[model samples]
Target: MMAAFKVINQYWLISITLICSKILPISSETFHTRLSPSYFSQKLGKIGTKLIINGIDSHYRSFFARVQHLTTPGFCGAAILDSRFLITSANCVHSVKPQDIHIEIGDFSLQDVQMTIYDVQDIFIAPGFNLNNTPINDLAMIKTEEPIPDAHQISIGICDEEDYDMINYQKSVFGCCGMGSTNKDPFIKLIPQVLKEMHFRGTPMDESNPERFLPCREDNICTRPMIDGGSICNLDHGGPLYKFRCGSFEPECLYGVASYSKRKADRHFQTCNTGSFFTNLMYFHEWIALTFLQNSF
Candidate 1:
């Protein structure tokens, strides 16, 4: 009788396991926190479908300065002010020392082991740069230990207040590039090995609701892609947003510096569905000019 009872209990447990498997399918969305090529391929069968959710490979005609820490590389992007100086977001270098900061310029492909890296001699965060109230005066200048080669230099000017006011900010297409994440999911960290460029236009602010986009005050410039689907993600902060002439490869005037992205209060990740915020260089023209002039002597 005891042997019979034990055998029945074993069969009952097996029956319950089978019932649970049938009720709950194995391929539920809750189990997947991240998306990948293999997951799609398995679900949709390999029918030659490709996923491109980020910017394309940028041409070498434009100049960009990549600002990062030696250990945490690709944290932000920057513009080469000259052979000896670079401009970036204050948040990128605020807490770090100059020695630990690494600046790499003119590298189309970051994977190349032969690429040269410059050392940081000094860093100056613009006055009134507050981490508590971020993206406000979110600008910084990096001084290189050795002067960068002049051959890589280009005549890029900062957009002044007059130009900013006269131009239709929402109408013109701006060129931006960075070593940012290719994937929309920031947690996945899908940073591209090559520099990628995307075209986006400034989003017009609502006069009635001026304070809707918090942390992004009147001084900041917001952007929306004119054509593409994805926006800038992590590792793109401190990058430049500039205007280029029609059919020209070289940038004309520097307007904005990448700062942050829009997200709800509860969400931990920054969404790419909307435009990203940038520190308006046009608003800080006086500060930048003064800094450059003082250092000149």
Candidate 2:
């Protein structure tokens, strides 16, 4: 069953998830032939109709990080925000101790794990956040045991009103990666088969759609794949939802962190074409900056 979590101003528990999909084998014909749409679908894979196909090292861009719970043997997706701080869902790390949390950056492949794991020194949750409530102020700033490398420039998510309206009106698609489990059973023993990339778009909640749910609440952003082949509800708990900047000259920008899915029909299982909800980064902008300012000083 999917975990039940609701953030109505107060903060609480839940996670965004990514599942391993079955991809067919590709060969020389795929590269040489002028293939059909179905061929490309098979090559790209129908599981997640996304920009970056899963498991391609070149496809990975900057600022992506993963949150691992050392005590629980589970992981959440996360992102680097600066040299000393990273961001993730507050609900994700809610009850965990600071020392038990580990953050991994500069790693594209979630498996064959690369780079040294950065241990967390302190975890900053939204000031108004309450562990007893739903995940409203659903963000967390993690201070690393040491500063990130000087060469790394973390992706800054869109928080200003101008960029927020631009992406929504433009119907921009965002990408996320997960090392989380699939909703299906027998998933317990499975390590993520490949680094999973899930696709979603920011959209208005249309309760009229009949196939989805409430879509989002006041502090949430609705994200869904354009087609029925994939689901955001199944991706990793703490993954970042990010988009490219307006031009080729610009870098990738993170905008949301996976929180919880607004389930349709109040059922634990997700239906086909269901939309998921994210902890809207802009909604927590003031808190984010304030947290950073207060701590940095």
Candidate 3:
């Protein structure tokens, strides 16, 4: 009887943790427009499949980290900025407390036992971050309690306006990886144990149709999957949007952070091929740098 009671208690604990993790403070004005990821996928259409439909397994990215709650697995993907700092979307940690979250790195698979997990020393959400808004300034920095081991410590690339513009206009192909839900079927939430990566093409601002694409503010960049039926969905949030050199599998520079996507007013289903918005990291480079300096021990 004691064992059975313990199992039931554990189950309830997990259920409550998941419920709390999903709660976010939203303004009434934006409530109708900005719904949860699952709702957005359901109202518009099916969310992407695979780790992104057709996404391939990424052995691992040394600089990538999984930012998640202690009880819930993960809500966002993050990029390591240095031995002590990492960056992700504000929405991922805005409502979370530093002591209640952890960072996982050096593991491609969620179930991998060799992954290193670290306690969060602090969390710094960007100024003027509004969860109800288009997740504007959707960036945050996390300081690890202890420096990550030297072997796994590396800086990720942050772009400047000039380079960002070039990539957008030149339509450079970039990639993102995460362990988000593989499929968006309302009845199913299929997240794989392995990290997955998919490539997307930069969608020039001029080419974006307001009628079809969500209202992408100046702080955001738009992208569409390189292939049909591909996209970054739930859990891909806060992951790096980065580029690679020709014929290279390694990431070269960071451009953006996966933010949010919305369906057209007239559309009933979410479509991965239409494109999605990412928080432009170049716009926040100065702020992030300043934050690093202020917090450096």
Which runs of model 1 end up more than 4 angstroms from their true locations?
1-53, 71-74, 109-114, 132-134, 206-216, 247-249, 264-270
| TM-score of structure candidate 3 | 0.75
Ranking by TM-score: 3, 1, 2
TM-score of each: 0.72, 0.71, 0.75
Q: Which residue pairs show collisions in model 1?
A: 77-238
Report model 2's TM-score to 2 decimal places: 0.71
- Score candidate 3 by lDDT: 0.68
> Which residue pairs in candidate 3 have backbone atoms (N, alpha carbon, C) closer than 3 angstroms, thus clashing?
44-268, 44-269, 44-270, 45-269, 45-270
**Residues forming the 10-long window of minimal summed lDDT in candidate 1:** 43-52
- For model 2, residues 66-158, the per-residue Cα lDDT tens digits are 787888867777888777788888877878889997887665653455655888889987766654323576778888878888625555655
- Cα error, residue 233 of model 1, in Å, equals 0.9
Better of 1 and 2 by TM-score: 1
Q: Give per-candidate clash totals.
A: 1, 12, 5
Instruction: State the lDDT of candidate 3 residue by residue for 6-122, as single tens digits.
Output: 533232222222222133454654433433344333432332445655566664677778887876656689998888988888988998889989988766744563778899999
lDDT of the candidates, in the order given? 0.65, 0.58, 0.68
User: For model 1, how does the per-residue alpha-carbon lDDT over 193-283 read when each residue is reduced to its tens digit?
Assistant: 6777766666655221234643336668877654346466677888888875532335678888887665444444645545567888877
